[model samples]
Target: MASVNRFIQFNNETINTKMLHQMEMLAGALADAPYLKVTTRQLIEFRPSESSVSVSVFWRHRPKQIERNGYLSDIYLLGAGYWRHFSIRAWTKFKKASTELPNLKEQLLLCAEEFRLIEKISKERPGTADAFSVRESIYRDYHRDRYKQNKQKGFLADAFLNAAFLQLRGEEVPGSDGFKPLFFLWSGIFDAKSTRDCAIVVENMLPRLEYMLEEDMVHSYYTFGEAVENIPPFRYHEGIESEQRDQEEEIETIEEWFQSWHRETEISEAPAMEFELERGDSSYAEGGREEEGTGEIQQTAKGDSRGDHQEDNDAADRQTEKAAKQASGKFGSANNQVVYTEKRIQVQQDQRGNIEDWRRKQAPYVRALLRELKKRMTQRRQDVRHNLNAGRLSRNLLPLVIEERPKPFYRKTAPSKELDAVFCLLIDGSASMIDKLDETKQAVLLFHDVLRGLNVPHDIVMFYEDAYEASDAAQPNYFEWMHKLEDGNRDHAQEIVSMEAHEDNRDGFAIRWMTDRVNKRTEKHRFMLVFSDGEPSAYNYAENGVIDTANAVSEAKKQGIEVLHLFLSSEPTTEEQAAFYRMMYGNKSVSADSLEHFVEQTLRLLKRTLHLVIQSG
Candidate 1:
């Protein structure tokens, strides 16, 4: 017996470009509002690899809707009110919200509930429907200017939810009785599955939440930026008791002990040769037998011999002595003591053959490495000496004060300064880079090589989704990703290069995490590089898609951290791939067709931008 209103089918379309624009509006509104808590910057780029985009979309958000419901919806990270269900008094608040909503959904829901109640009561009264109809007509008088106030207060409570009411005349929906259906309309379309999923969350709550819009505060912001300050030193004199005086003195003593701790003279790990070991002649490795000779002298002359420094030189020295003995004081025989020794001949012949093979196969690579090493030797020496001088390690007192030689003991490698800088890598883990995983990984590896060659202090990272999912291991690459703290070196990227893939999409978390990490680290030269295919959707965020991930790139740029953007998709358009423009904003974005190309381009860009020396190789 519920009083039925006219019905209108719900505009059950998915999110598309218009929806993304609406998100941008919402993000901008929240970012400017200062009352809503938001962590986002601005729109930077967009993507559908193989399809280029000219712009990016961004957002800011709060929990404004529910998650799972009925057979109509699917779960997603970025959507309206996903976390609101986890709050305290959700049922009470939501129900209360139904009475004072600012938009169509709430109004429709509130009307239906009231209609059902009055209709039932009308069954006992002869003219109940007529009486309630008159009351319903004036319901607006009881709820006037409410939704208007929300819009004035900064929430998009009206336009975003255009409403339509319909009353079905025939046999109605199973549990719906004769009540009308309230349809919520939006101007965009998204994927079908996602649209269906979003619908489920709206079905049951729309009727009840209409009234709560007036009570809830959704849009707000907080302050964040670096600013150092001065403040009084903390003192806890009031908490001290009379008996603790001695303990305070003990603490001072400990502090003094720490102050006097040794700063210089740790240990060095570079291997060095202190003394020479004897080497042997080629014949020493072979048997002492020889070829045709008029005498033992001729026989010995035909055999091989090697240098005195050679291992097993003992055999040659011994053989010389034996020959001298046979000559009986012929050590320097003026007679025919032909010095054509067996050992010398053999060594010459073998050395010539070995030289030919090495020259043909291994010389090029060896020479390249040697030249590079020699070019850097001076820099390496200065680096070691300068770093050691600046570090907490004290000067080498042993070289002057301790005249006596110290006993040898086992030593282990000290903590490496080579691992000194903190790195933040932001990767665009979107759909466009799906098949280009190998190339992206190669770019990462090439970066590793460049750093080692220049002795540049650095680390690696990638941005995927809005949040960061680090490499699974201590080291990460395109195939595998890890956020675990690790030192950078020639082999530092091996583990990551062996990884599988970054996830399928973006949520903006990774960029935020990268910014925060760079902000927190002390290294001014720290690097943050982003590799992506460029399609960044504002969906999949923690609080609907309230924060803009792209402009967050701009925010990071302002912080002075070095950011590199590398795009690995041939998809004509990719997300934010302008390197020079990125540099102007404080990041480097590279757009390339393949991984190999990315690697080459990154190397060239890094050397030019960082002013790092390129070794011979």
Candidate 2:
């Protein structure tokens, strides 16, 4: 009993496997169908006006809790049956009739298709076919009675019910001439009175239908509307027109809801200054090496020397070769595997005035933050007067006079807070950031001025991929240094103002390179922050870039560097975006809805860090 329970399981995996098998069979069967294509992006969406349709990703997954007990769940079978009977022509006709017919034409079209599919399924999987047919028949009869009670002409609805009954029983129904042909398609396969007939039909048709579908030679059994009645309810077209208007109104309501959710916010920053930095051709220059001076002498000696002399020269040559190999090995060991090249991109001289004006406007904010940081770092000194005064406490000679040894305690001074940290601000210069460049510059300037005031070493860099020039042979990666840690000044503020969005972003490589830079710093605390608007995207980097960056972040964390990310997005983020951020940064990522929020968050982080530093000091 334990083993049996252990072997039994129910979950999405089981559901997906079954559904995937069904889809594969259907796809194989309909390889030649031109009206629709199977997809896993949406649920039962049929756009007859478009080239293909979409199926939901959840189609292959089901809740496990629903499959408890030994009860046989028909959910998977019903879904398979639905797709098995899917006919492009029927869907297209329905799309048209839903707009053209009033009362029951579109419903009739769907009913006819369902019957045809049920007949075909009876020949293959009778159990599934019967189950679906029963459900369809019950709903059909219910609708027919409802329509009759409402005094609506339901002639077509009655025909559909009769057809559904015939498909379910594989028997002729009385007074339904329009559904007789569909019944004949399943004649002699099963009987209405025998459950044994369903079992027998299933056993026989499984092999036959599976093979037939795989060969792609099975003729489509559905006619979509070949057996529909000639006349439907009265005023059918008018009813359909009314239904179409109602559907349109519902769609408009849905669109309004989405629009309300995505209402645009106001922009709060100026446009970035136009830069004059020319894109430089990044190419490796090869240098020539000089030949060894011993070349001629060694050759001549080897040629002229006789027996013993030749052996001596050969031995010397061997020693020289070994020494040369050692030297080359050392040089090779010192060579960098990934050579990173970076330079400061100069701003246009004419734009200096505009840059200065912007900096002045932002000066007050920077100065206030600097003052707060400096105040937090300020230290207090205490003094003590005594015989032996060093720093904080003094010696007590009175105790020595009372026969106790003279004990001296120095008056120690409290040490000032040391900014023992390295900060790396890696900015995404992807083209999507073109609109947010100005605000990004302001944030960068604030970071720079704060760190500069605290005398902390930090590097400001903008990294992006030249999407246009990138190729398999050469991946054009560009990184502009706005400020270097070694420079110790914000004189390069112009570079930040001149920053502009460029092309695609390869975040993984950039993070890795910055990680390497931070790893080299001597500071006890290392911090690297990324500012990006979206996922890591580039011409060949879309799918793998996210994973690669995540791995790189893990590597940074392993090296004791704290990696944080700022999502610089203006619009309300979707679930997909949130999931992506969580995957990339875990709990270390924060989102900013606008430029103002971005500034506020940055200041908050700075103040918190300063407070912590002050407390530690």
Please write out the lDDT profile of model 2 over residues 458-517, one tens digit for every residue. 889998777777653335566777877756643667778878888888777788778877
In model 1, how large is the Cα lDDT of residue 42?
29
Best TM-score goes to which candidate?
2
TM-score of 2: 0.45
lDDT string, candidate 1, 440-533, tens digits: 6656655554455545545454433322432211111121233222232334444444434444433234454456646776654556666655
Once model 2 is optimally superposed onto the true structure by TM-score, how far is the C-alpha of residue 309 displaced, in angstroms? Answer: 57
Cα-lDDT of candidate 1? 0.35
lDDT of each: 0.35, 0.51
Worst 10 residues of 1 by lDDT: 262-271
Model 2: per-residue Cα lDDT at residue 425: 92
Off by over 4 Å in 1: 1-423, 429-432, 462-485, 488-490, 537-539, 542-547, 574-587, 594-596, 612-617
